[model samples]
Target: MAYRKFRGTKLFTGKSWAPEDSVLITLPGGQVEAIVPASEAGEDIQAIEGILSPGFINAHCHLELSHMKSQIPPHTGMVPFLLRVMTNRQAAIETIQESIYLADQQMQKEGIVAVADICNTLHSLETKKSSPLQYHSFVEVSGFIGNTAQNRFDQGRAAWEKFREFGPASIVPHAPYSVSPELFRLINEFDPGCLLSMHNQESKAENDFFLTGQSALRDLYTAIGVNIGFFQPPQTTSLQAVLPYMNPANKLILVHNVLTSMDDLVCLEKHPVADTYFCVCPGANQYINQSMPPRFLLDDQVEKIVIGTDSLASNYQLSITEELKLLADFYPEIPMSHLLQWATMNGAMALNMDKKLGSFEKGKTPGVIALNNWQVTRLL
Candidate 1:
């Protein structure tokens, strides 16, 4: 906690990272004490090579499924993927514990200061309690069985309460296809002001199921012994159908969005929620649906776009930088500056941790991360 100056070869202040000149920030006790130009820097400054910036924020992730890394095959689409996950989600407790620990450590190493993790059970609470990274647990509420709405709500609430002692946690829906109208209403009654993050239109099949009632999901549900005959097609996009049920007061996060079309963006207007945001896990999109969210679908959406790695189950690793790198490799026009904001400030804002963990502003304890040729390195 002693005084030190972390002078970098180049520094990205969460806005710009250019001019290729020296930048210096003096810190004592993990707080930024001063920011001075290279000309004003004293000889005591500790110079280092690389791009220094605030740490990354994984806006959406599933740390509980850490043990399922590569457990299910990729590009199977949502129906097959969900079937595989449902069938194979359970593993030995020790294995699940070890994987979660390692994944948390990897996120810390990759400069992730905060994460918005999806939780379906309390299995990951111990890991979150001991991890260096800050976590906001989204206790996922998922049940399509209309008659079992109360039970599902109670289960989700119990999970949220279990995680609440560890950190900020709230009950949220799992996905559009998984939650019924009754269950969604129950979630609203539980707490309409809390933040909600859920899978949106990850694939066309989801839209197909809700829009036309003809989708693989129908068969999959029957195969799993879940009665869908009582469920009727909305004849509209999934998001549109769920919009009316959502409380405008709550902060909504729509994840994946691989199949979100230009038409789907129009449906967003019906969303009364003013604090809604979008999270794109580019790697997971490609892994599960064989296509990433198109650059056009994301061009105007930049203001709301935040990055997440989804889970190791559908991803090779949990590094937010790698997610950005994949996008950069594909879309060369998306300025690195924009990608950095999506990784840091935007994500922190989405998770409501902007005041402490986003930009390297005065008095903010935003952790320092060095991007050495686009590879994430924790400097603080």
Candidate 2:
């Protein structure tokens, strides 16, 4: 393999940033070979600008919806915004294929090494098969009509099979408001150990729906003409209601915890909470929900905090650097080191890809990424 050495003013090898004179050596195939202090490098070294770090792990994304960028209006509350996505997500086959192709290229340019992408269909499977980036597909299963739960579960399984050929894949529920309790149980029974991801407490209406059965979601269900006959109000927060259906020790990823509360955290902490992760999509949250997640309050509950772009439908850019900048802008007290951890290593651990990606460990092929201001470029 061809050998290449990159010199950077600073290097963040997942744990901490190295000072000026850091050299990262890699094979042309991308596996890290060795690292050395800058003084030891030849004067003709290929120097990299800005912070040299491992490629960003977009813990969540929806590359399939790249065709819908700007199609939905911004700052609409979660319920209505979801409805808009449901109604507007349609295009010619070639249009979708082209958009997915472009989106994949954009992410590569932004230095996304791995993704935990949400999929409702296998439309983007072809793009994934040929792409160099790693993917862990989350086949999103959504159905509230109790009678159709089995059918929806089966369909999700079929989608999972198709998606698995490209990479690691699992059937995951979309959100508590959209997935019936029976469907959640069906998923838990299918594979308790598989990584399960759900949209958690993105809106007050989601909590209100489970706690009192009175939320805008009720009106949405009525307007959509779906009878939730098998559903029963849990009279608790949405997170608490679904806890019983999940295996406590199983890995779970909760996205957009804008409404997650201290009580909900306490309840989860009392159970097996070791493997749980909370992912924040700050841009998407601000764009679609008109709010920012109370991330500071959730610092103590989760083992790791990861970042995501959500989707093009809700975010303008797919860069984790932009997400970290927004987080730092909102909570200026948080250290850049911690934010870098969230964007890199924490995301890798969350997706269970840490063994191969995340940091510049000797023998690990963690892809190289360069960060400048709020943009990222994949150097390897």
Candidate 3:
């Protein structure tokens, strides 16, 4: 049951493209055997029209909130958004299940092969078990200030351990904003081998609260019965502040660094041991704050960046294509090929699944998607 041959006008071989080319893929399990000039295939070549590339990997998403598309009140700050989320928990959970079902279908149809999704609970366990796509679920935990830092770490570790029974891809985290410095220190001390994911400087208010200890967030914390009077003003950039508490050997996918300044990027560059990756959620940023992360921060660091749709609760749709399209529209000077890699290869790397899922390489089984009016003859 070998595929024998597939000739497309455009063939993306993960890292580069083959123009007017053909790939002789050995199937039974789809793996690229050889990518050669179209004329080299003789008469056995099967010409495939349109584009062909590796399946996409959405590096960061909250599938549990998939059901809340356009329903959560917009333009609210993060605190208000959280309150709204709490209020709508019951309805949101029901919608989350439905959204996950439809979103999974949409991912397949759009040629996505893997995801790095945030899980607040076990709600997504059954869905992941049933889906063909690869998943790395980060069990998210957050606490402002209460018990001992060791207690907080224990709570997070306990929750993660419970979910670990379901699969191989479970990880733990102290949610940003709410995670105490002491708890973060414990996380660093434990030094888990898995990658770290956190919402970093997603809002100006976050920066204000963390850096200066003054902002609208202070009011929100007070309202929520979490006093901020005893808290010390943050001494370092968010990335630096968290570095001591994270496994330096492990890569980090910093989500929504909308307000991350040049100093932060410099600090990241200084940490040679840190594999720092950025996950931009354009739609989610716009929904919550009427803005998106500054694309310029990614400049020469495009290779270190990936894309995510966030979730329907904070986005219009769960489509990586749309995310890339928005990126292209905003940063038209950037090459389309590079943008494609951000949505695919970079994403796979962020999820630590590049070895098996991201690219259309020798042994990878990433699905091929054809764009409308895409030229297959160009490949041949």
**Best-fitting candidate, measured by TM-score?**
1
Ranking by lDDT: 2, 1, 3
Worst 10 residues of 1 by lDDT: 17-26
Comparing candidate 1 with candidate 3, which one achieves the higher lDDT?
Answer: 1
Instruction: Give lDDT tens digits, candidate 3, residues 141-205.
Output: 66678466676567667767765675544444534567776666666566555677888888877
Clashes of 1: 0
**Model 3: pairs clashing at backbone N, Cα or C within 3 Å:** 9-376, 9-378, 9-379, 20-379, 21-379
Quote each prediction's TM-score: 0.96, 0.95, 0.89
Clashes per prediction?
0, 1, 5
Segments in model 1 whose C-alpha atoms lie over 4 Å from true places = 18-22
After superposition on all CA atoms, what RMSD does each candidate show versus the true structure? 1.6, 1.8, 3.3
TM-score: model 2 vs. ground truth: 0.95
Candidate 2's C-alpha runs over 4 A off are 229-232, 301-303
Local accuracy of candidate 2 as per-residue lDDT tens digits, 1-380: 45778887678888787665789888788898877786775555687777888888999899889999999889888778888888889889888889888988888888888988999978789999999889999999988866678999999999999999889999998998888778887888888688988899988999999988878888788778887655668899999887876776579889998888879888887766448899989999989877777965546633378899999999997878888898889988777777888888888999999999999888888889878776677788
Flag the better candidate by TM-score, 1 or 3. Answer: 1
User: TM-score for model 3?
Assistant: 0.89
lDDT of each: 0.84, 0.85, 0.71
